[model samples]
Target: MVFDFTISKQGNYAIISMNGNLIEKGQAIALLEKAEELTKEGCSQWIIDLEKLIYMNSSGLNTLIQLLTKARVAGGEAVLFNMNKKINELILITKLHTLFKVAGSKSEAVEILGL
Candidate 1:
C-alpha cells in the first residue's frame, strides 16, 4: 500500500504518524525529509508513530537514522513508537535500536521527552 504521513502535536512534542510502506526512493523519504526540515528549524522532540506501518526497507531505516542525527545535532531528540516486531528486528540487526530511543506507546515516548 502507498504511504501517508500525518504530523500533529501531542502536547509540546511533535508526532509523525506513518501508514503503509517505507522503502528506498519512496514517499517515505519525503515524509522523513519534512520531519528533518522541522528538526533543523529547532523542533526538538519527536514521536515517530509507526502503528500503521507494514513495511520498512533499509533505506527507510537510513532515513530514520539521518533524521535522528539531524535532530540530535540540532539539540533535539527523536523517539520511535509502535514499531512492529519485524521493523524492530531490522533496527536491532542494524544496531540502531541502541542509537534511538524506542517506546511501546506514544504516551510512553511523549513522557520520555518530558512533555
Candidate 2:
C-alpha cells in the first residue's frame, strides 16, 4: 500500500496516524513539516498510531526518530501506539524501543504523555 498519514489533536497532544508502506524519507517530509507547524502552535506532545502501517523500512524508523527529536526539542514527548507485530519487531531489532515510549492503545499513549 502507499504511505499516508493523518494528524489530529487531543487536548495538548498531536496524534499522528500512519498508514501503508513507509519506505522512504521523502514520503514523510510533509508529515515532519506539519509536525513542526503543530509544535510551533504549542501542540508538541505526540502520539504516533501505527496500526494501519503494513510495512516499514529504515527510512520509516528515521522518520519516527525525527518526530521524537522534534517533540523533545519542543519540551514535549512522543509516544507510539497500536503497532503491528512486524513494525514492533523492527523497532526492537533496531534497539529503538529503548528510545521510544510505546503503549498498547491510544488511551495508554495519552496516559504516558500524562495528558
Q: Write the per-residue lDDT of candidate 1 for residues 8-78, one digit (tens) a residue.
A: 86655688888888786666667767877787666868888888988989777877887788778878799
Error of 1 at 92 (Å): 1.4
- Which residue pairs collide, candidate 2? none
What TM-score does each of the candidates earn?
0.88, 0.98
CA shift of 24, model 2, Å: 1.1
Write one digit per residue (lDDT tens) for candidate 2, span 33-91. Answer: 99999999999999999999999999999999999999999999999999999999999
**Each prediction's whole-model lDDT (CA):** 0.82, 0.95
Runs in model 1 deviating more than 4 A are none
Give the clashing pairs for model 1: none
Per-candidate RMSD, Å? 1.7, 0.6
